[model samples]
Every structure is written in structure tokens, then in C-alpha cells.
Target chain A: MIEKIFVGSKKYWFWVFSLMALVGIGLCFYLEQFQYGLGITGMSRDVSWGLYIGQFTFFVGVAASAVMVVLPYYLHNHKAFGRITILGEFLAIASVVVCLLFILVDLGQPARFLNIILYPSPNSVMFWDMIALNGYLFLNLLIGWTNLSAEYKGLSHPAWLKPFIYISIPWAISIHTVTAFIYAGLPGRHFWLTAIMAARFLASAFSSGPALLVLLALIMRRFSKFDPGKEAIFGLSKIITYAMIANVFFLGLELFTCFYSGIPAHCHSFEYLYGGGRLTMIMWLSALLACLSLILLINPKTRNNTGWLTLSCCSVFASLWIEKGFGLVVGGFIPNPLGKITEYWPSLPEVFIALGVWAIGLLILTGLYKIAAEVKSQESNAA
Target chain B: MNRRDFLKIAGVGMVSTIFEPVLPYEIKPSKKRLALLIDITKPFDIKACLDACNKAHNIPEIEDPKHKIKWIWPERFSDVFSEQIDMPKEITIPVLCNHCENPPCVRVCPTKATFKRKDGIVMMDYHRCIGCRFCMAACPYGARSFNWIDPKPFIKGSNPKFPTRTKGVVEKCNFCAERLDKRESPACVEPSNGSLIFGYLSEMKDLISNRYCLRRKPDLGTSPSVYYLI
Candidate 1:
């Protein structure tokens, strides 16, 4: 099965090498950051977390979103999703890898990364988050590989794998929930102290994760013999439609709560995000894209059209990426506890490091998907 | 490889595990809950106190505001007390670690690198810190600062006795715990000329009982050890 990835077309090798080049460049910048300290990044005393943390938060959602397809296929026995579930699990592996790397690059003392496990503090939310993330990654790898290998061998998956599959269902929810607790539990950050933060994270994740999957499935159809199935693609678009609506509705609820209460501390962050602050443009653009995508997705006529469906999926993915990846994490720090506004913009090294991480994820996805496609093609040819 | 050898090792391990908790270790219970009282009404020399803290802690003098590390500094009154509706006369107020009883930083630290000591001071183990910056986010008062760069070059004159921090660790004031252990006054308190008072909270109650004192964001339930006499 592993040999399938190595024996690829010329185009595949070119793509693989391109990603390797990016990983190499990112490693060079990371070494510089390691020597100098986190000062190479745009983070300041006020906004201590910047691009790395924001990316970590966003990718956690992508990793957790694998549950959507897994639940329908395994629990409900939805036959259409059987072909696509492997793709979700594979995407999760790639996303979780990206997430862990972002955390590593963001650390000031990357060498001491083991200290979190060495002297574990159960009282801390971060301790639980570390456990949840690593556990989810292991679960996905075990479940995805076992199922894929069994399918390739033309045998039924082992019955013993049932419990792990069920456990992964709830475990996926826990990963995103713990990630939300990291920000939601804080006392002074008015913007992130909302009770609905976990719900918001789940909604955005459900929408965005599958939206990216739809794009990936379409890409696979173009380049490989694996057609993740038309029914499965449409099923995912339906999930994205409702989830994006819920995400937008949650944003509205936050707005009403902040303005109706008329509390300055509660209102200040919104003001920073929507009211003439540095993030105002980006925030508005995200809102616009969300609305645009929702309009396109809700209409059955447009959704049935592959071109419009692709457009809306791209919109959903981009909108949520900006809102969660850029706005939510950074907005929480604005108007710091002292009522001082210090904006953060990622440095060149920081952007390249992030891109490098994304490239690594893509490379992993390419290999895993290549194997999946080869097995599917072989099975179809025999049939 | 033999049964006797395995039995010997198991017995020793079992004995050590059983007795380790009961060992007669020197556990020093703190006799005082220390507090700092600042008399805002008095003319305070902010620069002198800042200078003393910088020299005492071996803090660097980095020109870049983004990467600057500070243990103690002065903030404007309006900014510090932004929740106040009526605008008071603007003045400089010294701010540092509150050493809160219910410290959010300690609760959020994954590695227990930042912890509250027995004497009500929040201590940071620089060596143990993974430089995650989670403490910086959890601290409501902006009390924590991260070593964004190697601080050695920026130190005008490094204090040999105090350890200079490496890049990527979080640090803040420990209420001069080292000085307290030596029975000497904090470097900042000594030069404050009665403007800053450092003593056990119980002993200083009489001094603050009659005056109108305030603690930063008391509503947050952090129970700050620092008090300002307005």
C-alpha cells in the first residue's frame, strides 16, 4: 500500500517536490526563530499569541470535523459515505499534524515541549487540550489505517475496531470543545468569555471542514479514478449549509448580547472588530462571504449545479478561515486589560513558517489520498 | 534474571514508594500572607522604584516596545481604572504582579511552571517554562511578560547574583520573595519613602483600615494582595 505513493505520475512527483521545497524554506526560518527567540514574530507583550496560535485554533476544528462523515457512515450505516469517510479521516490526520507543528513553532522553548507531559497539571485546560488533541490524532490514525487496509485486502474490517470507532465520535467533539475552553475560560478577555464559544467553534468547524472536503473530493475526481461519489458530495454540502447558517446566527446572538447589555468592556472588542478598528475590513469581508455562501448554498437550484456548489464551498471555507483563524484569536486581545489597543500583524518569517506547515499537511494528504485512490481503482478494475 | 533478583528490586521499590510520603521532610508553613500597600495620595518617585526593580531583577533595557520585558512599571490612572465612570484627575500609578490568591495564570499553566507560593506570591520557574505564553493571556492585569529575545545583550549592567532569563520564558514580579527571605526590604519599597508599604497583610491592616483603599478589578475575584490608598 505504501509503495502506491512512490510509484506516481510525473505530475505527482512535481507536486511532492514543490511541497518539499516549502517545508525546507519554513525549516530555515524556524531555525532563525529558535536561535533568536519568539521576538522574530509580531507578537508583543499585549498580543502574546499571534499567527501560530491562531492557526492552531483553526486547524483543531478541521481535525475535529472528521467526525461528521465518520458518524454518518459508521453509526448510521449510510452507504454513500463509505467511500468518503476515509478521506475525512485522512484529512484529519493531515490537519492535526499541521496543528501540532504550529504549536511547536509558536513555542519559545520548543525543546521543553515535553514538560507539558513530564509535569502534568490536571487543573489546567491546556493539559486537557494536549491530551484530547494527541488522543484524537492517534484514534484517527488507528481507525483510518485499519479500515483502509482491510478494504484494500478485500476483507471485512475486524469486529474489534467497533469500540474505537464509537469512542472517536465523542472524542472528536472533545478536541474542539477543549480548544474553545482555552479562550472561553479566561476571565478578562470579554470577547471570548461567551458560553456559546464551543458551539460557535463546532458550527464553524462542521461547515468549513466539510467545505474543504468538498473541494478536495472535486480535485480527486479531476486527477484520480476515486470519485468520492456524487451522493456523498451532495450530503456534505447539505451539512455545510446548515452549519454555516448556525455559525452566522451565533455571531448575531453575540452582537445582540454585547450591544443590548451596553457594557463597555463587552462592547469594546466588537468595536475593535466591527467599529473602525484595524480588523474592521477583514471582519466585514468575512461577514460578506458568509452571507454570500449561505445564499448560494440554501437555494436547491444553485446547490445542484456543480459550478455554484464549488463557488459556495470555496466561500464557506475562506470566510470561516478568516473569521476563526484571524479574527477570533486576535480580537480577544485587543483593548488589552489596560484598555490599550496594540494591533498585531504577522511578520514575514511567521507567514512563511505557517505556509510551510500547510505544505507539509498537503504533502501528507497527497500521499494518503494517492494510496486510497489506487486501491479504489484496483478494486473497480477487478469488478 | 532470577527470581531472587526480581524480588529484591520489587521489595526495594515497594518500600520506597510506601515510605516516600511519610518521610520527615522540612515543610515550612508560611506564617504570613504578604501584601503591598501603595499610598497614591503621596508623591511617589516612579522612576526611582522602576530603576531599583530593573537593577535588582537584571531586567534588560530593550528599545523595541514589542519585545521589552518589564517586572514593574507605571501606568496612567485613567487606563488602570477604565471601568470607573467619572474621570478622575490623571496621575501615574505603579502596576506589577498582584500575586492574586485565585491566580488565573497558575490555573492555566499546563506545566505548573507558574505557581502560587505558600506566602501568597506567584512564582515563575523560568527553567520549567516552555514559553507557551498562556500565562500572559490568562493574566488579567497584564502583569506577565515573555522573554521574546535573549535578554543578556540588552542588560546595561547585569547583576551577577540574580539569574538572567533566556529567550522564550514568561516572568513577573515575585513580590521580592528573595528579599523577604533575607529579612530585607524590597528594593522598590526601600526607596518609596512611605509611598509603598510591604508587610504581612495582618500587620498592615491597621494602617489601611481607616483609609480608603482599592484593589484592581476586585470584582474578578482574584483577591489581589496589592492595595492602593486613593
Candidate 2:
């Protein structure tokens, strides 16, 4: 089993080494954070949640977006996803792992996390979120491993696996939907307190998630044996376009409602994001980049260019992060009940800790993909 | 549905239906009642509330270094402003645990830690609260306060008698549950004497109507135990 993972030209050793180094740095940074307290991070009374929670919110969506591929490839029989669907399931597992870790880091007492379960609030969306994340993690792991193992033996999967894949499709959507509920359920938080929130989350998740997967597919082709065909890429690209269009459309509706209704509660958060206030620059930059990403993806020409495609994928991801992580979470607190804008910035230790967690997630993704690549290579060689 | 059936179907619970806040809590003209009176027109004296609370509910008095918010009001509109006036010709709405017949907090509490009293006051078992803040988020009145830090000693050495809450959990006013049990009035109203009224909410609602004139978020249907002398 160990030899299978090390099937050596020793190329992967470099990735493993680099990951190890990052792990060491991450540990040092996290230790400093623990010594001080969350105060080590930029978060304060106003921005109680910083990059860790923000990134957690963003990545959970990415994890959920795997449903796009999972649903269509397996249940709907979209032939375009035939060769690459397992990639999406594995990606879901990796992304959920990251999402869970980010939440762990954000907690004031990571150890007390089980208390959430012990003292679970079923009515609270958080309880449901925990349920979804754990459920999705188990479901995807089982499905990905079972299906891939079947692929290795070159045999059909048993009938039972089919239903699990179908269940995962909706479960993926639920994970992010429940995440959006974490925000939407807040009463006075203007930006998050929208009925449109869940729809907007799905829109963004569907778009950015598949876009990231597209880039991953591109990387695999460039670096290894798993070359997902253009038809598959194009199908995913179309799905991405549809979701992006919806995401942008939902954002537009938010703009119109906040402006037209002219309610301060609704408009203030928008203003905070778009330049009516301190976060204007970030809001503008995020909006511009995100908008441009969609525009680029929309056009058949630029969307097809690998370089441009990668750039746009990053732009969309960053834009969504700015919207959810920064504006949505922090803006809600400004003009706190006293309506004061107490600013927030994550400390260096916080940043490092966050980076460490991201590095760990990436390492997990890298390891899993390496094993998959090897297995695929062996299968093809046998054939 | 029967209690047994509801719990079984819900597949989860806080079994104590001890005091379900529905509405029209027992109209006994004689039973002692509890509530808080707020002049919502001005910045609420969260500090005053903390200062007044000697050892509210047996929970240790946490001296908020930042005085981290015990209460606040957005002060929405003209009617709200008018409603808060001293109203020698005006109002003073008592608050603290609406102990509503339909208390939103009790409905939403994940852990059955918060429940309505036989007296119809919403109460929390501090011991059971894990501080998830979901109850805080669910509460519409902004009545909840998270234990963002250790409970500060009210005095330099007062036996540190209040509950010391760890960070990450939430807390709020409990109508001085400890005081009520000891056969005393809530500390806030002790100063009000007759200026603040406590009794069966039904009778008190009538008193506010006949005497000072009463009103609340009538539309919300919370059936708040609190009533204002408008």
C-alpha cells in the first residue's frame, strides 16, 4: 500500500517537502496565536470573525459546488462528465476537510467544539450546518473511494452506490445552503438578512466552484495522465457560465432592492461594500474583478483561453470571498447598535495561522490527487 | 398533539414544559410578577441596569470592563421617540424576560435550557447554556449578552458571587430569578417602588391602560409580560 503511493520518479517528493515546510511554519504561527488568544488575530469586537471564518464560508461553497458535477455525471447521465466526475467527488472531500478545519481555527475553544453537538440547537442553522458538513464528508468519501476502487478493478459498482451519489448531489447544495443560513438568519444584519441569500449562495457556489474544478482539470492534463476532454471542460464551462450569470443577476437584484426601497438597513451594507464608506476600495475592487471574471467567462473566446480562464477563475473566487467574507460579515457590525464603525484587521499571527490551515488543505488535496493520478496511470497501463 | 407525541415526532427536546409562554399567563390578581421598564427613546442605561443589579439571579455580577452592552435600542422612529418621554405625562416600560405565552426565545432555544415559567416568565438555566449564541440571534429584542469574557467581579471582593461565564457562550437578564425565589422584588424595580408595577401581566396590562396608558409591539404577538405606562 505504501509502495503504491511512492511509485517513484521522486517528482512528488518536492511537493511533499514543500508541504512539510509549510506545516512547520503553520504550527509555529498557530502556537503563537494560542499563547495570546484570538487577540493575536486582527478580529475585535466589530470584526469578530476575520479571514478564517470568511475563508471558511467561501471554501464551504467550493466544497458544495462539487454537486454540480456529481449530480449531472452520475444521475442525469451527462456523458460530458463521464471521465472526470470522480475528480469532483474527491475534490468535495478535500474541500469539506478544509472547510471543517477553517471552522476549527475560528473557534475560540477548538476543543469545546463538541459542545456544539452536545448542546445542539436543532432550530439553529449551525446545528444543521454541522450535520451537513459531517454528512457530506462521509458520503463523498464513501462514494469517491468506492467508485474509484471499482474503476481500478475495471468492474461495475454495486447497485447501492448509485443512491448515495444521488443523495450527495442535494446534500452538497444543502451544505452551502445551510452555511448561507448561518448568515441570513441574523435579523439586523442588513446584507445577510435577505430571503435571497440562499439563492445567491447557490449561484456563487455553482459558478466559482466549477470554475476552480476546470482549472484543476487543466492542471492535471498539463502535469499528469488524467486529461479530461474538451467536451467535459466545455460542459462545465457552460454550467459555470449559467451559474455566474445567476450570481451576477442576484447581485443586481440586491442592488436594486437596497437602492429602490431606500431602506437604510438594506442599503448600509451595500454602501459599505461599494464605496459609500471605509471598505469602498475593497468593495469596488472585488466587484470589478468579479464582474470582469463573469464577463470573461461569458464570452466564448476569452473563456476558452487557458491563461485568461485561470485569471478569471481567480477573480470570481476572490470577488465572492470579498462579498461573503469581508462585506457580509463585517459590515453587519458597523454602526453597531450604537451605529459605530469599529474597524477590524486580522493580526499577523492570525494571517499566518489562516495560511497554515490553507496550506494544510492544499496538501490534503495534493496528496489525494497524486494517489488518484497514480491509480489512473496504472489502470491505463494495464488496459 | 400530546407532549409524548410532540417529543417523539420532533426527535429532540427540552422536556420541561414547565412554563410555556403562550399568552394570558394565569390571571391570578394576587401572584407577584416581575418585569423591566425602559425609556426606549434614549440610549438605554445598560450600565444603570448592571449597576442596579446587585446579585441578580444568583449569577455572579460581571463588571463589564467595556460595559459590553447589556441592552440597546435602534430608536427607530417618531412614535418610538414620543413613547420614551418622561411623560410626567409619559412612559416607562418595564422589561426583562417577557415570560411570554409565546416567547420567541423559548421556541428557538436549541437546548431546552430556556423555558417559560408556571408564572409565565421566560427563564434560562445558566448551567445548560453552552453559549452558541443561537438563542441570542433568535431573540428579537436584543435581550441576550454573550459571555465574551470572564465574568468581572461587581466589587473588588464580593465573594465573586456571580456566575463566571467563559468566552463564547451567551447570557442575559433573567428577571432576577434568584431574587424572585428569595421573596423579594427585582433590584431595578426596588428603586421604582410604586413607580414601577409588578403583578399578574393581565391585571398589570389593565392597570397601565387605565392609569398611565399602555402599549407594546402589538403586531409581534409576543404577548410580552412587559407593559409600558405610556
What's the TM-score of every candidate structure? Answer: 0.95, 0.82
Cα lDDT tens digits for candidate 1, A1-383: 99999898899999999999999999999889899888888899999998889889999999999999999999899999999999999999999999999999999999999998888777788889999999999999999899889989987689999999999999999999999999999888889999999999999999999999999999999999988889999999999999999999999999999999998899888899888887899889999999999999999999878899999999999999889998898899998989989988899999899999999999999999999899888887877
**Model 1: pairs clashing at backbone N, Cα or C within 3 Å:** none
DockQ (Cα-based) for each candidate: 0.49, 0.20
Name the regions of candidate 2 deviating beyond 4 angstroms.
A1-11, A20-50, B1-34, B39-49, B54-128, B151-155, B192-199, B211-230
lDDT string, candidate 2, A30-121, tens digits = 77655444545665544456677778888888889888887787778898897678778778888888888877776655556675566655
True contacts kept of 1: 0.80
**Docking class of predicted structure 1:** medium
Q: How accurate locally, in lDDT, is each candidate?
A: 0.90, 0.67
lDDT (Cα, tens digit) per residue for candidate 2, span B134-202: 555455454666544444533333434445555545566666666677887766656553555555555
Worst 10 residues of 2 chain A by lDDT: A1-10
